[model samples]
Target: MIELTLIGIGTGNPDHLTLQAVAAMRAADLILIPHKGADKDDLAGLRRAICDRYLGASTRVALFDMPQRDPGDPDYHHRVNRWHDRIAAIWQDRIAAELPLLSGKVALLVWGDPSLYDSTLRIAGRLELPLTTRVIPGITAIQALCAAHAIPLNRIGAPVQITTGRQLRDHGWPEAADTIVVMLDGESSFQTLRPEGVQIWWGAYLGMAEELLDHGPLPDAAPRIVATRAAARAAHGWIMDIYLLRRDRDQQAGRA
Candidate 1:
């Protein structure tokens, strides 16, 4: 049976790698790292760095070009499905070439926990090969964001909502929760919300050398976060960021 292990490596920080993740990397016969082009070289580079640091000498590493989603297609899910199919094809070809009989263990290093906003699992499901899969969870961006800010994820006895920037922008703050954490946000969607009683805690490139952090009331912090995000992305050519928003406790109390 072909063993496919999906390992989460945490945010960009090498130190975030768990013992289980390290063991999985060393045990694999081959590891696949996706190349996202020069603009996102750091993504692949970080994977390589981790391999160099932990993988055994007998393990081999392979790089594959990540498939780009077609922006011309307005239907997001359809575009994503096509892109994933292309990626599955690439994975099939690479495995055939690298692990001739497709009998050895292969691993893919994913960012954050595969169970979160990541699509590695869904893409793997499209592979034609018979495979046994396993997952080693890693710290997620939400964990990194909360750690960097030194804050808890939720208020006392309250629910916390995790969402994408697009969702926050399109749906507004969730009525069910006082705390909302936004990820995969390219547009600083927090700006779309009323600033009156909301506070934001934001972090970019969390756990890396170039990490940035900011926090304060939404109205006062939104513009600075936008400008800072733009500047950082220009400087590094890419950035992964997340933010947490909460309605003031007093404000909620007043409403009640």
Candidate 2:
């Protein structure tokens, strides 16, 4: 049986590895790390660092190129579907080549909690092997953002909506929530929203020693965040950011 474990290593933090994740890494017959090419070599390097720090000395480690997303396709969802299929094929090929007799256990180092905005599960689903999968939860950017800003995700008797940057731009504020946490945002979607009295706590490179954070009223802070995010992304060649926005009807009644 090909047992696959999705180990959540958290966002750029080696310390985010849980005890269970460590054990899983130690038990794996093979560990796969996706290479994102030169511009994003840091991602591949981080995966290597994790493997170097963990993974029993005898365990085998494999590296595979991550397939690129096809932007020429008009249908966004269709493009993503095709991309996932390509990645699954790559994974299959690498596994067959590297571990011909592999059977016991295998794992992939996920950047964040597998259940949160990550496609590893969807890709793994395409494999026909009678494989059982396990997800080891780790801290997500949302959690790190909240902690960095000293804010509570949910306010007293209120709900928090988690969404993508695209939806925030197209649909505006979701009526379902007074608090919102946005992820997988390539653009500054918060600026599109009506910034009246909304509070924003933004974070990038969370958990890393170089983590950066900023927070203030959306109206007062959104522009700064937009410019800062742009500069940071340009400087680093890539960036991952997450933010929490809270709206309070009462002027004096905002609390983390």
Candidate 3:
């Protein structure tokens, strides 16, 4: 009976951790951090930094190599499922080795809230062991993004859609959503949209020391964001970014 606790650490910022998240981390018997190779070593380092700050001297910490997703696979869902399966197997092995008796608390520090576009919960569901899962929620990238820009996520009485960059590129803006938040986009998918009457707020490394932000009408800001993102990714070797797009209903109506 392994009590697995997935604690959201939030956007690589130590201060973003909630009191509940700190309590859960301090209570864990073992904490597993995933190493995503050299390019993203800073990500693993951030987790280590958090553990160092929050955990007691007796708490155990382990690092596991993250399984890379197959980029060649045409079906995104199949590729991700296979990757998740591999990760689950790794988690099982690590837990068993780290805790031979396997009857204590195990923790994984997730980036952003586990409930929002994150797959930690989904991967945990695939574990073959007897497990009871607990989630400690933390700040989300959306929250951090909105905070950095000092803007609300949605207009009064209006809804906002959250989707991936792939969806935006493949399907264009959702017909029902006037505002959309795009995540997991390596490509500048906003380039695919018709820029007229649309505004965009883009940020990379949000809540981190290297944070960058740019916003304006889509047509004007797109070029600057592309340049900035390219330079930052080149300098850092890895980057996590998100953007918000909102269509001005009045401008659209005026055009119509």
**Tens-digit lDDT track for model 1 on 188-209?**
9998887888989999988899
Better of 2 and 3 by lDDT: 3
lDDT, candidate 1, at 40:
95
Best by lDDT: 3
TM values, all candidates: 0.97, 0.95, 0.97
Candidate 2 all-Cα RMSD: 2.7
lDDT of 1: 0.93
When summed lDDT is taken over every stretch of 10 residues in candidate 3, the lowest stretch is 247-256
**What lDDT score belongs to each candidate, Candidate 1 first?**
0.93, 0.86, 0.94
* Candidate 1 lDDT score at position 228: 98
**lDDT by residue for model 2 over 1-256, one digit each (tens)?**
7889999999988988889988999999889998888888888888888889986687898889887898799998999999999998888777777767656688899988999999999999997666798888888888888888877889888888999998998898787588889998898899887777789999999998768888998988988988999998888888989999888765324332
Q: What TM-score does prediction 2 earn?
A: 0.95
Residue 54 in candidate 1 has what lDDT? 94
